[model samples]
Target: MKIGELSHLTGVSVRSLRHYEKKGLIASVRLPNGYRDYSPLTTETVDTIKLYLNLGLTTEQIAAFLTCVLKNKEAFCAEVLPVYRKKLADIEHQLKQLDQIKTNLIDRINSLQQEEQVKNE
Candidate 1:
C-alpha cells in the first residue's frame, strides 16, 4: 500500500509515518514513479511501535527491541521481558510517590475540615 493507506490504517499521521522512515523505525521502498511503497507489515510494525511509545520507551529503545524481534522472532520475548520488568519497576516507584501525595492531600483536607468545624462551633 501507499503512505496514505498505511497512515489511514494505522491511524498514524502521514508525517509521522514519514518521520518513522527517517528515524529508521520503518522502511519504505521507492517505486518507479518515486512514490514510497510500504508493505502490509507496516501496519503490524506501526502497531508495535505505537505500543512501545505508549509505554514511554524512547525511540532508540524501540529500535533496539525491533532489531531483536526481527533477528530472533522466537526469542524476542526473552529479550523484551527484562526491559518491561525494568519499566514495571519504575512505574511501581512512581506509584509509591503518588500514593504518598494522595495521603498528604487527604490529611490536608481533613485538617481544613476540622478547622472549619471548629469555626462553625
Candidate 2:
C-alpha cells in the first residue's frame, strides 16, 4: 500500500507516518515515480510503534524495540529488558515529581481557602 493508505488504516496522520519513516521506526520503498510503497506488515509495525510511544518510550528506544520485534521473537526482544527497566525508572521518577507538585498545589489551595474564610469573618 501507499503512504496515504497506510495512514488511513493505522489511524495515524500522513505527516506522522512520514516522520516515522524518516526516523527509521518504519520502512518504505520508493517506487520509480518517487511514491512510497509500504508492505502490509507495516500496519502491525506502526501499532507496535504507537504502543511504545504511548508508554513514554522515545523514538530511539522504540527503534531498539522495533529491531527486536522484527526478529523471530514476535514482540519486544528480551535483550532489551534492561533498557525498558531504565525507561520505567525514569517515568517513575517523573511521576514522583508530579506527585510532589500536586501536593504543593493542594496545600496552596487549602491555605487560600483559610485566608478567604478569615477575611469573610
Candidate 3:
C-alpha cells in the first residue's frame, strides 16, 4: 500500500508517518514512480508506535526496543524492560515534583488568607 493508505489505516497523519520514517521508527520503499510504498504490516507497526507514544515514551526510546518486540512478537522483551523501568521512574519523579508544587501553593494560599482575616479584624 501507499503512504496515504497506511496513514488512513493507522489513523496517523501522513506528516507523522514521514516523521516516523525519518526517526528510523518505520520505513517505506520508493516505487518506480517515486511514491512511497509501505507493507500491510506497517499498520501494526504504526499502532505500536502510537501505543508507546501514549505511554510517554519518545520515538528515540521506542526505536531502541521496537525491533525486538516486533520481530519476537513479545512486548516484554529484555530490551524493553530497562526502558520501561526508566520511564516509570521518570514519571514518579515528576509526580513528586508536582506534589511539592501543590503543597507550596496551598501553604501560600493559607498564609494569604490568614493575613486577610487579620486585616479584616
Candidate 4:
C-alpha cells in the first residue's frame, strides 16, 4: 500500500509516519512516481510501534524492541525484559508517590476544617 493508505490503516498521521521512518521504526520504499510503498507486514509493525509508544517507550527503545522481538512477547522477555520491567517499576513508583500525595492532601484538608470549626466556636 501507499503511505496514505498505510496512514489510514494505522491511524497515524503522515508526518508521524515519516518520523517513524526517520527513526528506523518503520520502512518504506520510494516508487518511481515518488510515492512510498509499504509492505503488508508494515500494518502489524505499525500497530506494534504505536502500542509501545503509548506505553511510554521511546522510539529508540521501540526500535530496539522491534529489532529483537517483532511483536513476540516471548522474544521481548528474552531480549529486553529488564527494560520492560523498569518501565513497569517506574510507573508503580509514580503511582505510590501519587497515593502518598493524595493522602497528605486529605489529611491537610481535614486538619484545616477542624481548625476552622474550633476558631468559630
Candidate 5:
C-alpha cells in the first residue's frame, strides 16, 4: 500500500509517518514515481509504535528493541526490560519531586491564610 493508505489504516498523520520513517522506527520503499510504498504489516508496526509512545517511550528507546519484539512476536524483548525499568525509575523520581512541590505550595497557602486571618482580627 501507499503512504496515504498506511496513514488511513493507522490513523496516524502523513507527517508523523514520514517522521517515523526518518527516525528509523518504520521502513518503506520508494516507487519509480517517488511515492512511498509500505507493507501491509506496517500497520501493526505503527500500532506498536503508538503504544510505546503512549507509554512515554521515545522513538529512540522504542527503536532499541522494536525489531526484536516484532521478530519474536513477543510483548517485550529482553533489551526492553532495562528500558522499562529506567523509565519507571525516572517517573518515580519525578513523582517525588512533584510531591515536594505540592507540599511547599500547601505550606505557602496556609501561611497566607493565617496572615489574612490575623489581619482581619
Candidate 6:
C-alpha cells in the first residue's frame, strides 16, 4: 500500500512514519513513479514500534529489540521478558506508595474528626 493507506491503517501520521523510517524502525521503497511503497508486513511492524513507544521504550531500545528479533526470536523474547518484569516491579512499587498515602490520609481524617468531637463536648 501507499503511505496514505498505511497511515490510515496504522493510525500513525505520515510525519511519524517518516521519522520511524529514519530511525530504521520501518522501511519504504520508492516506485518508478517516485511514490513510496510500503510492504504488507509494515503494518505489523509499525504497530509493534508504536506499542514499544507507548510503553516508554526509547528508539535505541526498539532498535535493540528489532536486532534481536532479526538475529534470534528466542533472544527477543528473553529481552522483552526482562523489560516486562521490570515494568511490573515499578508498578508494584508505585502501588505500594499510593496505598501508604491513602492510609495516611485516612488516618489524618479520622484524627481530625475525633478532635472536632472532643471540642464539641
Best-matching candidate per TM-score: 5
lDDT of 4 at 93: 99
Model 1 per-residue lDDT tens digits across residues 6-107:
999999999999988988999989999999999998898899889888998777777767866765672645757777778899999999999999999999
Superposition error at 39 for model 2 (Å): 1.5
Give candidates' CA RMSD values in order: 2.5, 1.8, 1.4, 2.4, 1.4, 3.8
Q: Write the per-residue lDDT of candidate 2 for residues 1-121, one digit (tens) a residue.
A: 9999999999999999999998999889999999999999999999988887887788888786687776657444775687678988998999999999999999999999999999999
| Residues 18-107, model 4: lDDT tens digits | 999999988999999999999999988899888888989888877766866674664645647777888899999999999999999999
Give Cα-based local distance difference scores for all models: 0.87, 0.87, 0.93, 0.87, 0.93, 0.84
Q: What's the CA error at residue 90 for candidate 3, in Å?
A: 0.6
* Candidate 1: residue pairs that collide: none
**What TM-score against the true fold does each predicted structure earn?**
0.79, 0.87, 0.92, 0.80, 0.93, 0.61
| Candidate 5 per-residue lDDT over residues 1-121, each given as its tens digit | 9999999999999999999999998899999999999999999999999999998999999999999988985554788889989999999999999999999999999999999999999
lDDT of 1 at 42: 85
Off by over 4 Å in 1: 30-35
Model 1 worst lDDT run, 10 consecutive residues: 70-79
* Superposition TM-score, candidate 4 onto the true structure: 0.80
lDDT of 6: 0.84
Clashing pairs in 5: none
Candidate 6 residue lDDT tens string, 25-45:
889899999888999999988
